[model samples]
Target: MSVKENCQKIEERILKACQRSGRKREEVVLLAASKTQPVEKILQAYYCGIRYFGENRVQEGIEKIEALKDYKDIHWHLIGGLQTNKVKYAVKYFEMIHSIDREELVDEIEKRASKMNKIQEGLIEVNFGEESKYGVKEENLKKLFEYILTKEHIKILGLMAIPPYFENPEDVRPFFRKLRQLKEDLEKDFNVKLPHLSMGMSHDFEVAIEEGATIVRIGTALFGERI
Candidate 1:
């Protein structure tokens, strides 16, 4: 299918998920996970009415951002593990970082944002005890939130998680639910509103939306398998 057709199908699914969960369609942001996609394909998605794009690597994201600089309306997001050295460029290029899993990254983002005099918004990545994922464990989430609260230049917008993959999307529901509950618990504990839950990917986004995902990162389902 063409990008336009793929987008139509995805939009329909998003709408259905929103209806199932009694949420507004406008509440969820469809972020194209344009990790390895070429700039032309990215633009195809843009013309198809997708304004949000996510990149997994800082350097790749920078190249795309520079390439697409003329399209000022596009919102770029960093949705993968970030190295400390890339924080400066990540802060300057991406509107939000969705893999903040450690205190060091928080400190680095704060410093970079302060240097640039910009408020860097981010999501705390919570690991579901997955050995391979890069995220703070659920038990340490509060401590991380407390530490992040002290940073003047960085803001925590919500939580993100890349749950272990399951062929059945329903099996992933509990992980999404846990992430939503964590977001709620943090809001109550800190009296802050974290509005974006950056969870879900191509295979299970509908489930994520049903569990309160405000941002759904889609790649293959939108752009086809990576070339």
Candidate 2:
């Protein structure tokens, strides 16, 4: 599908999901996951009014950032695994690091940010279900959050989760719902402001939005399957 067509279809899904959940369509944010996609496709997305772009690798995202940083005000999100050694490039280029859950890595990011004199915007990746790709385990999230908050060079904006994907998108609702509730519980019980829920993907974003996902990472739905 063309960029315009993908954008239209995604918008329809967002709107339909919002309506289904009794929320406004404008409230949900669509982040086009552009891993392996070229700058030209991103330009196409920009033409279709996509402002947020997500990349899954630091090296690949840096390439895209260099190619199109001047072309648009695109917010680059690091949606893949982030290592401590690569914190320098990540801190310099990414607007948000979406997979941050380990305390040791968080320390490294803070140290690197301190050296660079920058406070990086980052999210706490949580293992919301049986799928354990790259997030901190559920029980350790609170302690990790408390420890990271003490660091001046790193700010915890919200949470990110990759709920286990089922062949049927409807089966994905429970995970999204759990993530939303987890954020709410963390805020109320822990007395912290976590307004963002960075969950959902191409196949099940509508379910994510219905469960209150502010940022949806979608790639295949926008740019087709990755090579």
Candidate 3:
């Protein structure tokens, strides 16, 4: 199927999942994970009513963002590892960063964003799967949240996670539930409202939606397999 048809199918699934979970379709943002996808494909998805696009690398995203600069109302999100050196470009191009896993990275982003005079919106990526993964552990989340609040240039939107891949999408539900619960606990503990839960991907987004995913990062399902 074409990108538009894939997007339509994904939207239909998202809507059905939302209805099943007693949530509105608008509550979840379907971010087309455009990493490695061509600008033409991204444009196709955009024309099909997808306004949010996510990229996994700084330089690639920069190219796409620069090329698509004329497309108004497009929200770009960085959904991969953000290097300290590349912080400057990532801050300038992407509206949201979803893989903030450490305090040092946050510091770099804050410094760059401060210089750019931009308030960088971000999500705290948590590793609910394995210890070797690239995400903040659940235990250290509070400390990270406190530290981020002390900075002036960044705001934590919510939590994101790439759970262990499973053949059955149903198996990924726990990680989604855990991320949602973590969001809830953090909000109550810090008295802060985290409005975005950037979980889910092409393989398991429907389950992620049922578990309170405010933003689902869909790639292969939207743009076909990455090239």
Candidate 4:
């Protein structure tokens, strides 16, 4: 399928999923996960009405920005494991960082955003159970939420997670459920209004939305298999 056709397919899927889940079509935001994808693919999606794109690496996203700067109004989001040392480049490129789960990374982002005179929004990534991942464990959310409240430059927008992918996406339900529960628990305990849940990807986005995902990072489904 052509790039425009690819984007349309994804949009149709989103619209159907929203209707199934009893959500408004506009409620869920589709983020193009253009990690290794070329600028042409991104531009095609943009032309087709996709305004947000996500990258898993700072360097790759910066390269995309340099190549596609002419396409203004695109919202870039960082949805990968963020290194503290690479915070500045990330701050300069991504409007939102969705995988921030540590204080060091948050501190670096805050420092960079302050120096750059910008308020960078961030999502706290929670691992829920998979110990082999990069997100903050579910148990530490309260403390993290409290600390995020004190940060000035980086606004705590919501939570993001990458549950261990199972062959059948249904196996990942427990993980997504935990994330949704954590969001509710955190909001009940603290007065934080975490409105966004950046969960789901190419494989299990439908499940993610039914579980309350506001942002779905889709790549392969929209751009074909990555090389």
> 1-227, model 2: which lDDT tens digit per residue?
88789889999889999998899877777999999898888899999999999988899999989988686678898999888888888988898999997988898888888898998998999885455488988788888888887889988878999978699988988888877777787888779888789988998888889889999998999888786
Q: Weakest 10 consecutive residues, lDDT, candidate 3?
A: 127-136
Error of 4 at 143 (Å): 0.8
Each prediction's whole-model lDDT (CA): 0.96, 0.87, 0.93, 0.88
TM per model? 0.99, 0.95, 0.98, 0.96
Q: Tell me, by lDDT, which candidate is best.
A: 1
Segments of candidate 2 deviating more than 4 angstroms: 129-132
Error of 4 at 138 (Å): 0.5
Cα RMSDs, all models: 0.6, 1.3, 0.9, 1.2
Candidate 4 error regions (>4 Å): none
Model 4 residue 150 distance off true place after TM-score fit, in angstroms: 1.4
Q: lDDT by residue for model 1 over 141-214, one digit each (tens)? A: 99999999999998899999999999999999999999999999999988999999998999999999999999
- Model 2 lDDT, full chain set: 0.87
Clashing residue pairs in candidate 2 (N, C-alpha, C atoms within 3 angstroms): none
Residue pairs that clash (backbone atoms under 3 angstroms), model 3? none
TM for candidate 2 is 0.95
Error of 2 at 31 (Å): 0.5
Worst 10 residues of 2 by lDDT: 128-137
Candidate whose TM-score is highest: 1
**Per-residue lDDT over 9-88 for candidate 4, one digit per residue giving the tens place of the 0 to 100 score:** 87888888888889998899999999899888888889899999999999999999988888788899999899988999
lDDT of 1 at 26: 100
